[model samples]
Target chain A: MKISFPYMGTSHIVVSYLFEKLGFEVIYPPTPSKRTLSLGVQYAPEFACLPFKIVLGTYLEVVEKGAEILITSGGCGPCRAGYYGELHKRILHDLGYPVEMIVIEPPLVEPLDFLRKLHKIVKPKGIFNLLHYGRIALEKLKALDVVESTLHELRPLALDKQQINQAYIEGLELIRQADSVKEVIEAKKAALEMLESVPADHTFKPLRIGLIGEIYVVLEPAANHDIERLLGERGAYVHRSIFLANWTRDNVLAHGEKDIRAMAIPYLNQMVGGHGQNSVGEVVRYAEEGFDGVIQLAPFTCIPEIVAKSIMPAVSRDKNIPVMTLFLDEQTGQAGIETRIEAFLDLLWQKRKKQEAS
Target chain B: MQAYLGVDVGSVSTNLVVIDDDGNVLVDLYLRTQGQPIQAVQEGMKQVEEAIKGKKIEICGVGTTGSARTLSGVIVGADTVKNEITAHAVAASHLVPDVQTVLEIGGQDSKIIILRDGIVVDFAMNTVCAAGTGSFLDHQAARLNIPIEDFGGLALQSEASVRIAGRCSVFAESDMIHKQQMGHPTPDIIAGLCDALVRNYLNNVGKGKEILAPVVFQGGVAANVGIRAAFEKALGLKIIVPDYFKVMGAIGAALLAKATVKEKGETNFRGFVVSDLEYQASSFECQGCPNLCEIVNISVDDKVLARWGGRCGKWDTLSKTG
Candidate 1:
């Protein structure tokens, strides 16, 4: 079966490997672009958020490329993301596209729903067979995640830009070659070892930057223009706020811990009602941690980020941290970003020098 | 006594608030943005000037927030220019020592803030949608020919609630019309609309985050008892709407300005005379690249004050003569 998947942060990396392992031909949508955004904006309701537009863009592009089965992830909450899959399906149907959309909701929430989704996708012979396949898939997924995380760390350290690019290409190739769970594990180990050999100058002082923002822009390389790589090439140590492990801990396990903790200080936790609290917390933490700078990345027209943007100044003041907010849209230009980044780095270096002189 | 001035110029509103050295509000004014932020800021400053007309107020610091903060800051010679999130979180923390989640649905957008121990940890904003925003409700009210002032009161009077689809404004409109055609009473439909809006907000903007108790609902929408009741029913928890709901952003800006002044020991306010000046704004689409950014320039007496919005700093560099 030919399967198509919309990009879901870095979740695609794991799911793609799993689909390939299950003997399904996987066709991933091309990286996000202006054309993708335009197409999405045209078809989607005017009021849908930018993320929805980007996702719709991916689906439309992949479906047009003749993929039969569409795979998407699902969520549940007060956030708009949970309902995107349903709305997307309706939109595609309205647009006269005949394709089966398989939404993979959080399986832990409802076991029956999870089983139903699995049945629709795989049609395993029995429960034992399904479990067996699931184990192997899970193993592969874990391995893929490990390699991706390691690469994320190394991408900012390589001496030459080409070295980082080559390392990623090699790692992706290894992932593609794995035939089983054990093979995937071995492949990940080999990829990490290969990355370790890439030479680093160790002479230049790395500018330490903390990246804080919404999930998609933080993890999706295409969405962020491979920001970590760009900054790493300039000898900056990029500290990303979102990690798969942290996400699982926060959203899956101790999901409400932050809110619960905020309860003691009602003024701070006002629950103005969304990700605004989390954004503020991350900025404050980054500031307290003494990062040279903080970059707040969010899709254009994102409300929580707007709130967070409003709050960052005081965080900057209280902790004496400098923050730069980048609002991404279809019109975001490479040169414009590069200039701002360079200027920000200059400011950071100047501050460091002034601190030393004083 | 030392004082600080903070201006928050949002797309829908412009606000100016003055705070004393101890972070106490002395003067506050909130006005419609009316598509001209310069004029709004001038008017807001005039109100602030008049309120503290006789007090020996020394402007020791000035800060700006919101979408138009940059322009307003440049015009007012602000000591600090910041974003809305930090300012709001800071003020919210100061006001309610234990605010966990901040639910702010304003004229144009909605925001959710997750706080941990007086610091913001996570946040989400809905700047693109009208469904979960006050504008959507305003539009619906105009269509229903219901006075926006009486909307919440009428909604509270409903004995039976009618269900309206709140997925999108278009969908909600059709659903509301369908309900009305089915002989649903105005009060029931209005209350149902409020519930539908609340449902849409939870479904769209608040997805995937844990919403704990001690939620504070601020912004202009907080005044609507119907929506507040709907939120309470939906979340099964009481929400605290602060006394200064409509001017929270402005108040936050004022508090931030106060903090900055205490830390920096100076101010750069242009004062109330700015209200009498003629400010003009012009925009030109940059043709340097396909981005075609509409660079906006604001000026006083043909002398440029600030230039922003172009993706590339081409226009910014050119307008540096200001």
Candidate 2:
């Protein structure tokens, strides 16, 4: 069976591996680009969030390439994302594409149903082999996260940013090519070593900026217009609140502690759906950690993020941290975003200067 | 005889200013951009030279700011390339030393900058919306067949203010037409528009921002007395519009260039003769990737000067080295 999935940052690397292990021809969609976005935008319901349109575009692309099965995560929140699976399926059906769509809801939401769905897909191979392959995929994910985090930390300090970019690409390639847990571990070590060895001005002090927002735009560079790279290039240390591995461990494995969510209780006591509460919680955490500034990124017209954005100014005032929110969508111009970011950085720099003088 | 030149190439107009070492304005010129920024900039340079005919001013530094800052920087060899917000804030502070808030309405965008102790503390710009900008007012003026220069004077004659929707330009236009069809006076309609635009600016771009005094309002739209009065009536604070209101961005760029040159002890001024050079801007879609980024290349005398607009830095890097 040929299977396909949309790109969600580096998640595709590990996802394609798992599908190959499950004995399926995995044909993942290409990185979200202008062509894919237009295709998706052409047929998507007006006002759908950016991620939906991009993913829909990817599905259409893969369908054109003869992919028969499509696998996507199902959302379980009040946000519109929860209905995207059904909407996309309907749209594709209306477009006359005879493709089977598999929606994977969180296991905690429906444990028996989840296993039943899994049983239908996976061969009756022993559980041990499945576990082994899952372990390797998880390790690869962890390695990719480490490499990305390292790049974020070291990029601002590097004299030759090109070297850091090259190392990051090489690290991703190494992680993608590794077939076993041992090889993944070795690849991770090598990648880290290569990243750390890049020439850097260690004495430089970079302004630390925390990024918090909706999951899709936060993780996907294509969606957010490579904001992480832009911030890093401009001598700011970027600390993102989300990672694929951390999200999986928290959502799927349910292993992470609840302390982070607790941070939002003072401002947003209940679940407002999606990552709205998490964004507020992360901003509080970033403020407490003495970060220079915080930026919230989300797709335009996003409901949960609008909720978060409404309360951000109060959080910013109370915490005494500067916060800026950027809404990403089709109409987002790179120049406008860049100008705002530059002005935000200027504000941070001037604030720091005033503090030092005092 | 040393002076710094600043160019602000915006969507609607191009402004040029020359300031002496002590930051005294020597010359200021504002011209319509009219969709051709390159020609507008070159024409601005020629005019600046003509205006300072006998003044033996040496171009010690150059700066560029606005939407076309990067392109203007390449043409003039600017010592500083800064964004419009910072330039506006800097210029406001330079003129009104104790300015706490700045409300700037330009052609395509409007922004509010909150400053404390001469440092930018908070700011916000309208996102993908041009509802309450200079272009909005200009379009209405043109549609009403009233000369744009007479828009403010006519608006000032209103006895009763009509309420016009200003949520979006489209809605505002339709609402204005509806009001006109209802036999409302032109001055009242114009006055209503000014009020609606001010309300929209304060509610949207100026949302959640503390608009403290001494407030400075400067931009192309500041020339409109109607909008200025609307702002004053809304906030109940007297607005300060600098003498060089329309060219504040260029003045700010000049001020920044002065500071940059003071620090670096040198300048990147390519000289006034660059105005004589033939400049061309051309763009093509890149075929190497599915992104199909439209790459823009600016050249002078058939030699490529710079390339940009590509998501990947391949063409950008190639332009620099080649």
Top model number, DockQ: 2
Per-residue lDDT tens digits for candidate 2, residues B1-322, read 9998999999999999999988789999999999999889999999999988898898899999999999999999999999999999999999899999999999999999999899998998888578989998888898989888999888899999899999899999999999999999999999999999999999888878889999999999999999999999999999999999999999999999999999999998898888999998989988887667788888887789888887656787754545
Give every prediction's interface RMSD: 10.2, 1.3
Q: What share of the true interface contacts does each candidate keep?
A: 0.02, 0.51
Give the number of the best model, judged by lDDT.
2
Candidates in order have lDDT scores of 0.73, 0.89
TM-scores of chain B, in order: 0.94, 0.98
Off by over 4 Å in 1: A1-358, B318-322
Q: Per-prediction TM-score, please?
A: 0.57, 0.97
- Expressed between 0 and 1, the share of native interface contacts present in candidate 2 is 0.51
Compute DockQ for each candidate against the true complex: 0.03, 0.66
